[model samples]
Target: MMHAVVVFETLWGNTEQLAREVAAGLGLESTDVVDAVSAPAMLEDDVDLLVVGGPTHAFSMSTDKTREAAQQQGAENIPRRGIREWIASLASPGRDIRVATFDTRVTSPRLPGSAAKKAMKRLVALGFRPAAKPHTFGVHGYSGPVADGELERARRWGEELAATR
Candidate 1:
């Protein structure tokens, strides 16, 4: 059986919500969601793909403050984590896993593409082959309802990844 894991850092639950949508599209019978902060290193075991995401803050991945703001808004912080911390905790053996990245951001109607360059770089350093290009979902300001169609886009991305796997 193929195994996949979706890990993310979210603020105001927008990215987290997107993560769930991606997972649903993957349609895996066995899957797990872990907070980027407190997730264990062992979660990397034997996974076929790893889906990682975070809110885009200052044109980069979400920081510790991002998670904090989300929690401050009443979303429970599941161990208060960040990608840096998560990277520090990863076990060495799973470096061969495939990976794709996603981020939540405000779609600057004027800008050409979503700001996800850093996300792609991080995944490459972690040894994940992109199952698909890194994607970005739009948010309104700091928190988000998610711009129209972002969720659908995420679902499609998920399906495509699963098909390739």
Candidate 2:
């Protein structure tokens, strides 16, 4: 079985729930789901895959300013640091480690950018290999219960990611 770690940042819990579902699909016995703020700066030697995700904000990944704005909009448990900051802190793994990324965005008024795409590029720059293309999961609104069926899609995506390894 492949060992995987899923790191994520969530403003209103939609992304976090998706992260958990992804981990479950990857096989809970061998996967760990962690909030970005608490995620490790470097992967363990035995880890085969790293999955990262967060909510899309202002067309891409969340920043401190955006997180603060979310808090003002009644979002609770906003992370002190978001995916961008956490990714900035990552240490190069020094060997090939597969990675996949995902993001949650509003379902309406199709967005122009993706946090997942941006994150995938950064991780690749840091020496992690892409296991698959970046993916986006939809939510009903800014603060949403995720769009119907997205959770299952995320799970299937996770399974597909595992198969790629």
Candidate 3:
């Protein structure tokens, strides 16, 4: 079985919840789910998969500025660091490690860009192979009780990713 790490950055907890569900579907015994602030900067030798996720901000991943804006909007427990900074800090893996990316976005008024897409590109540049196409889960609003069935959908996506390994 593949060993996987799921790292997520969230403002309203929706992305973090999806990350947990995804990790659960990946088989909890083989997966480790962590918040971006606590995620490792380098992949362990035993890790075969790296899954990353964050909430979309300004059409892509959150920056310090965006995070501050979110805080101003009543978001609490916001991470000091976001996926962008965490990804920037990652050391290139010594071997090919499969990677997948996901994001949580508002359900209404379809977005123009994706944090997952940006994250996937960055991971690829750092020598990780794409395990699957980027995915997006929906939320009712910035601070959301995620969209009705998005959690289940995210788990299904994780299951599909596990099958690829």
Query: Root-mean-square deviation of each candidate, in angstroms?
Result: 3.1, 0.9, 0.9
* Overall lDDT per candidate, in order of appearance: 0.72, 0.92, 0.92
Candidate 2 residue-wise lDDT, 53-162, digit = tens: 99999999998888899899999888988899999999998998999999999999888899999999999999999999999999988899999999999999888988
Give a tens-digit lDDT track for model 1, residues 1-165: 778888888757788889999988888887677768656776546688888888766556555675576567675643465665676567644457777888787765433433356766765775667677788788776666888888888888888888995
Query: After superposition, which runs of candidate 1 have C-alpha atoms over 4 Å from their true positions?
Result: 65-79, 108-116
TM-score of candidate 3 to 2 decimals: 0.97
Q: Candidate 3: misplaced stretches above 4 Å?
A: none
Candidate 1 C-alpha error for residue 143, in Å: 1.1
Q: Which sections of candidate 2 miss by over 4 Å? A: none
Q: For residue 138, what is the lDDT in candidate 1? A: 84
The deviation in Å at residue 156 for candidate 2 is: 0.6
Clash pairs (backbone) in predicted model 2: none
